[model samples]
Target: MKRLEGRVAVVTGGASGIGFASVERLAAEGARVVITDLNEATGKAAVQRMADAGHAEAVDLVCGDVADEAHVADAMDRAIDRWGRLDIAFLNAGVGGAFGSLLETAVEDWDQTFAYLTRSVFLGIKHAGKRMGEGGSIIATASIAGLGGGAGSHGYSAAKAAVISLTRTAAMELGPRRIRVNAIAPGVISTPLAHRGKESNLEALCARQPWPDTGQPADIAAALAFLASDDARFVTGETVTVDGGLRARSSDVLGDNSMLLAGRTGMNRGSTGLKSGFRNTDR
Candidate 1:
């Protein structure tokens, strides 16, 4: 049976990476998918490819900046106008952002990161929720960095952390209407966002993962499919992590555990040099 037959879905950042994979997966499951991205040419090409792949009737393309409220509203309007309703919203648009130390980071960069990463999700939920009926699913692309620091840059991590927090809060507010809000916290995925279109670079990093294979966009897409289907009808306000066991073990898994373990024994080794490790020694 087609899991999402007759359903309508909107995927932001659908031009590439996990968003594109989710668009494909949902369309394969019989969803009428609306692909939204900032790059008009790339987005149109992606939709054309889907059409070539036999999903012609199931795909539409909408190009816009997700961070712009007007653009977001228009995208939703376009979806509802075409399909008469919206059933799934995947707020996955984001930027790599400027990487630097706290003092070196610019305020404008921070604002821009949050605007696209966090604010976009908020706007998506706001508009999508208004148009949805009883059984809608809203999912966002958070990051393993949201859980801790080592996973990403400062601005990116902060934005994703807010995303994780927002997912729970949105779920609480939307649950009364039978709308499910959740998030996917992906680890180092082999997308342009992480590997910069370099497969060899991604493969090199994959060697350190417990799964020993870099996470493909399809890996996260599978999770998106599940969350969008009836299989996760009871799930909401949860952040499902899709890291290849990267978060299970610290970055220095093969390195010294003595420093971390020592902190657990109440050792006062407080310093301002290193970043992202156990800070409390109460245990």
Candidate 2:
């Protein structure tokens, strides 16, 4: 659609998964894209694929770690040097934490999680916002876990929650400069990260989706492209959920007996306060 024509975008972790998909989408929409990834070889290959597809001038690759401020700053500087300006920045680099409860999680794991997920986003916003003068957009890849309590991994949930809060505050602060900041909360997307586990678990997770299927990297890339385009000029301080309706259904489910008892005791009152034992059962 050429929605991002003449614009310049920097995507961290752009060698794989959602970040790579975003790079492809932005390039297709006529934006000059610079990819920053920790994997040097894959990052170059990703750019080469784009160049081979006749987008040679529209793509650039930078090898770096998002968790490092110097690397991020250099990446941004490279984009500006090439394209002369930066219009969009997608802070999509993140690492899955070790699966464990809060008490079982180690301090180093928590530090690494915050470094890659939360602190990386912070640095992206700080440096990208400075390079982009006015009318720029910053989109971060937050997860559906950011919206509520998570299961299994405490570090991932906490970091994602911090990302959401950071996005909102940045939106408010950067609004004065016409810089929009937003986040996308994706659910159960089939990517390299998810496939790193057992195939059975991945299948089971996908099967439980409310919709007919799970999400893909492109699904999130589409949402991010929209947020980056001028069409979303008025969008800010918002989080768009692209989870295929999985999260919309309330997670609270009870047995028939419990439902019957609550109904009989007037505990399941319709959005109205009611006394049930020692608790308010209006929900």
| CA lDDT, candidate 1, residue 279 | 29
For residues 1-283, could you state the per-residue lDDT of candidate 1 as single tens digits? 8999999999999988898999999998889999999877778888889989998888888888888999888888888899899999999988775355554445766676788888999999999999897779999999987888656666777889999999999999999999999999998787876765467756645676799777889999999999999999999999999988977887553333222333332111111111222223532
Q: Using lDDT as the measure, which candidate wins?
A: 1
lDDT of every model, 2 decimals:
0.81, 0.80
Q: Pick the TM-score winner.
A: 1
Name the weakest run of 10 consecutive residues (lDDT summed) in model 2.
266-275
Q: Which ten residues in a row have the lowest lDDT in candidate 1?
A: 265-274
Q: Candidate 2: deviation at residue 17, Å? A: 0.9
| TM accuracy, model 1 | 0.87
Candidate 2 Cα errors over 4 Å, as ranges? 197-199, 252-283
